[model samples]
Target: MGSVTELKAADGFKLAAYRAAPAGASKGGLVVIQEIFGVNHHIRSVADRFAALGYTALAPALFDRAERGIDIGYDEASVQRGIKLRAAIKLEDTLLDVAAAVGALKGAGKIAVVGYCWGGSLAFLSATRLPGLACTVGYYGGMIAAHAQEKPKVPVLLHFGEHDHGIPMTDVEKVRAARPEVQIFTYNAGHGFSCDERASFDKASHEQALARTLDFFGKHLKP
Candidate 1:
């Protein structure tokens, strides 16, 4: 169970967010970053799932800066549209929105960030740029290698699909070599393996990656 709420970024830009709270006491907070598809049903579901696991989870509508109330499907046209919207938005602005969400969750205790697709790269960037995050996890972040020189201020975990055409193994290796301190893993699936709504969804990879992510959060975010 989650609800939509408004949040203001550091720059005074108001955006929408989906927030879910644990039924009882919260162990910590989790910031779930959305894919290029926006903070759609899948992202909300992710927040709800984390809430059920005893964390107050929030998913900010990052695309709200470019276009508000954007919820699109997983089609070729939608993919192209998402890419265009992402290109129009700046990473610095998105990180500001994420910092806003993290500020809103301050009372929940230690905070961690996890993201998918474009949000995945944003999550990694948050670990390196933002403050107050305990750790970070990213899935299939194609842009991570380009920014591998950036050092994370906190522990970070990254996952990639071995068959992901968007992210080559060479890029993954580059990140690994450049940032040996960051934990990196690869699965036998393609891009978007964690997304059940996509054709690339792989149940085995999703389950395994989720388990590792939860364990990482438990170790890093728990009080």
Candidate 2:
């Protein structure tokens, strides 16, 4: 349902992106940000799901800036490597890659962004910095608390795990207090609860978050 394509950012950086088109007419476009693990099978599956929902979806390889073609597993070693790669890449560079992806989805109509893990933070940042977005959804983004003071330029929906060790409930509270206008939801799951490939995956939480996210895109991205 999807194919890999090359995209050029404003900085002339060429990166790979997985693009999935709807079977019939597209309702709009969706930019699916990847976890620190890069645009692996899970991320591509996410794009495919959005495509099945009648939206043209694109998942950019954001880790390409530091190291290309990164596809790691959910093991502890992979987690450490992913974190190191994420730390090496700047947020601005990731946003530039996101802009390139949004550009590739031109003419698909209104666009919305959704992300998981490290990508979740990028999604929230995209709402504040990137243009041509109608809305954004983020799931358990640890860095979001650091940027809580940055108001979103577009409508934003955020999901968090109440027991996420990496993202304390205190930080979540800070974001809620700072951005009262944003819609935020907390589940009884842990970090990476939405990813079935992870040990902390919670079926109930993942389904609920996905339902809310689809409804959000429908309300904001569809005409």
Candidate 3:
């Protein structure tokens, strides 16, 4: 389910991508965004999950500028490394990587973006900034609170945890108030709840969010 590939983003910045082909012809394409932790095993698993659902998936290494081959597990030191990596990279460049991943999946019938944590912010940006995107989904995007003015032309879904310290319920309400048309949901879990590798992982919430995302792609990504 893993294929190493190269993509060119803004200013011809070359980055690495992990791709998993859907078991059959893809009904759509899923552009999976990575967490602040980088495109680690968890992100790869997400791509495989989408592929299992018949959507060709690609996880872009948005932190390629910070470190080329960075894949860290969730230990204290590794978490610090991830934090530094997250702070080192720029959001503009990250979005460029996302755009490049979308371009690389040109053969798929339609394209949707799903992201977690930092990637979640990228998902929101994709829906608002990138053209030709079918839809977008974000899980606990902390940065989105600051970028609340951005709006999606296509459909969008957002999943957040009520207990998430990184993103408060007030900010979620602000987002909802700003974009009433977009679907938003809240769970009792915490930040990074969709990631099984993280301590915040909530199985029920993750499943429900995944189902809603699949349904969104189904409706928007018509072949």
lDDT of each: 0.95, 0.93, 0.87
User: How many residue pairs in model 3 have overlapping backbones?
Assistant: 0
lDDT of 2 by residue, 1-223 (tens): 7999999999999999999999999999989999888899899998998899899999999999999999888898989999899989888888999999989988998988899989889899999999999999999998999999999999999999999999999999999999999999999999999998889999999999999998898899867
On residues 41-121, what C-alpha lDDT tens digit does candidate 3 reach at each position? 999998988888888899988888888988888788987888899899777777778889998889888888989888888
- Please, what are the lDDT tens digits per residue for candidate 1 over residues 110-199? 999999999889989999999999999999998999999999999999999999999999999999999999999999999999999999
Clashes of each: 0, 0, 0
Q: Which candidate comes out best when scored by TM-score?
A: 1
Q: Report the Cα lDDT for residue 12, model 2.
A: 100
Ranking by TM-score: 1, 2, 3
Number of the predicted model whose lDDT against the real structure is largest? 1
Global local distance difference test of model 3: 0.87
